[model samples]
Target: MDSISSRIQEVTPSLTLAVTNQAKAMLARGEEVYGLAGGEPEVDTPDHIKAAAMLAIQEGKTKYTAAGGIPELRSALSEKFAADNNLEYAANQICVTAGAKMACFNAILAVVEEGDEVIIPTPYWVSYPEMVRIAGGKPVLVETKESNGWKMTAEQFEDAMTPATKMVILNSPGNPTGAIYTEQELRDIGEVALSEDIVILSDEIYEKLVYGENKHVSIASLSKDLYDLTITVNGFSKAYSMTGWRLGYTAAPKPLAEAIEKIQNHSVSNATSFCQYGAVAALKGNQGFISDLRDEYDVKRQFVLSRLKAINNIRVVEPKGAFYFFVYTGQLGLKSMNLTDKLLSRYKVAAVPGIAFGYDEGIRLSYCTTLDVLNEGLTRFEQFCREH
Candidate 1:
């Protein structure tokens, strides 16, 4: 009638994007602002992929395609899963969406019902719980300790389950935490999932960003049973620097995949047709660009860790993958938002407050910018901490 629905009302806006945008506004006004709030890579999209898109446009491949995705892209994705992740998926089992986030959203909405419980670990990506809430599901958050490397143990998973539990979301090389669950650890969790018959949404968007000896293993790849129960979500945003292209996909069981496709039919129809050609190139082209990006991010990761270790009064869990350091600011005795505001207003640096990610004692700093920019931001951040 007179106003928006309660569903829309319940959604909290993304504080991460808000802080990044605010920092950009300051820079536009000639202020020297160092922004660490954004979650995108600074690298430009690879030239080969861009060329593919241009070729698609020239060939007039811009018309509407299938609601799921073009067969070519889906076929490439199927091969990607088999070769890289050690998981086999038919082209029909894949649903290409606008982004990995949308793949997750559609998966949650397709299976989760009112009052169903979706288990999410603490200090998770800000979107998971909200997406569950939007689907009329209860988000049951289980806290994972910093001492535990922000990983949920099998015991913790067991304790969180209930008769109403419908799904569990996993972000390996997790956002904010950068924690990748080890193979044995995933097996332990997978054991619980199998025993409980809970569906797993494995978000492996940052799969290519691991550091040191940490290997990214798809939990679904561990066993046939686990594979049957998992919906593996991935995209080109992180690995290929294709965030603006809005391409991501999911490989699920055929039945679940069809349900997601039906939802897509009524929603945004499908991902852009020509952009999908770029995605195909991303999957099939020479992957040397990824190794270069990883080498650069590895350097940044080491620099970030060293800098954080030198700072006093803050404890940062050393991250093994992804581009963030989730620093604990609890000892400062200020709420995370207040701490972020102080950093922004006093030092002209931006980072997402930890409260936005379901933790109150910390903030998240992304190292997706250039090394010089990151160094400058950390300098201001250190000065702010010292002055306060």
Candidate 2:
């Protein structure tokens, strides 16, 4: 190959995937490794959803359908946004795609252009900045601190916005940090975004994975102006344990939804046909599965927090949502990548380095594994810290 496109060059490999794969390779070699890197839920796809997919297959619903999504699933999603999030959206304003990741990608491509600045918060999901880079938009990262719960402030949001600012990416029940913005926090930031006329790509993929007294609030539900300026991206993966089903959708204003649909149409050409039915089943049939899962996750979250607390010289804010603990390891006197590599190669524990999420001297530990695995990993991590 002579040379790859610069756009492709601008993108970086996902650190979460890299750590997960490295752990898998270690296990393949018959080594004992505790993989605490990935964010995917360990639960199987719910039976009702799987049954719906099977029924669709039996009924010959495997053929190509609408480029955006099946009408039934879109309608179900519209009802879901309204009933659950208090956001009114019609099927015509929804664009379903392969994953919430793709939904975000489509929305970014639809709205962002060259030289446009997209404001993102620090300790963000690894993909947000890379997606902006690939879209030819400059990613303006606003650093939020652990002291402030890793949540962006209205002042920071305003300070980052320039005349060139075109969009802002918001991830709640956020990855790595597990921080969820409160209704007031979102309203404050939403005001700045509204005043600047910046569109918001609100990634709510982890909305249902929240814990404690914490609640997930959609900025779009705060006001009509916020709703018009926000692209709410959600999916069946986190809530329904349908990661492999690859079905996610965005609810936006009609014109933006159409743009997302057009991008989805020319690129992936809709999600898998039968999987859409499974998603429909997920939205319509689910009532109790998520609650039970949340209870279990809450227990696991506490266990992880306790383990991290016992380890000396590690600083971690208690996570209120999602399933991660962003543990600061600056006292260990190692770069984040080196610390992560040592954890995997020497300690037989796998974790993603904080540098991957735009934070230094830290690592992200996901507690979405079995109790036995979590115990072993935390034990090894504590021992490694003591040795250092």
Q: Give a tens-digit lDDT track for model 1, residues 119-229.
A: 999889999999998999999999999999999998999999999999998999999999999999999999999998899999999999999988999999999999889
RMSD values for the candidates in order, in angstroms, are 1.0, 0.9
> Model 2: residues >4 Å from true position, as ranges?
none
| Cα-based lDDT for every prediction | 0.93, 0.92
Checking candidate 1 for backbone clashes, the offending pairs are none
Candidate with best lDDT: 1
TM-score of 2: 0.98
Give TM per candidate: 0.98, 0.98
For model 2, what is the alpha-carbon lDDT of residue 149? 97
For each predicted model, how many residue pairs clash, with residues at least 3 apart or on different chains? 0, 0
Clashes of 2: 0
lDDT of prediction 2: 0.92
